[model samples]
Target: MATGGEAVARLDDGRVIFVQGALADEAVVVEITEAKKRFARGVAVAITERSAHR
Candidate 1:
């Protein structure tokens, strides 16, 4: 998760992934639906770790 409350992650290939409905500092599983040259967009499919803020 990001500082702004959005989930920002990096793939193994170094691609940037963004997810909504996620808490900052939380660990989650995401499913990518769209892929671009620089980044990919997805939603939080599962939350592995709950954040204190959530």
Candidate 2:
């Protein structure tokens, strides 16, 4: 998780993506909303696997 509360994750290509409304250890399918050189911003389009802690 980030300081801003967005769940931080990495893509298959290793780019960092900040996902909205995601919990720690959750498997989410993200829809990329913004792209940048070092990171990306996205929303969880679908929760592929919900977090057990949630």
Candidate 2 runs further than 4 Å off: none
Q: Which candidate is the best by lDDT?
A: 2
lDDT of each: 0.83, 0.93
TM-score, one value per model: 0.81, 0.89
Tens-digit per-residue lDDT, 4-45, candidate 2 = 889999988889999998999999989999999889999998
lDDT of 1 by residue, 1-37 (tens): 5665568888888999888777778888888889999
Per TM-score, the best of the predicted structures is: 2
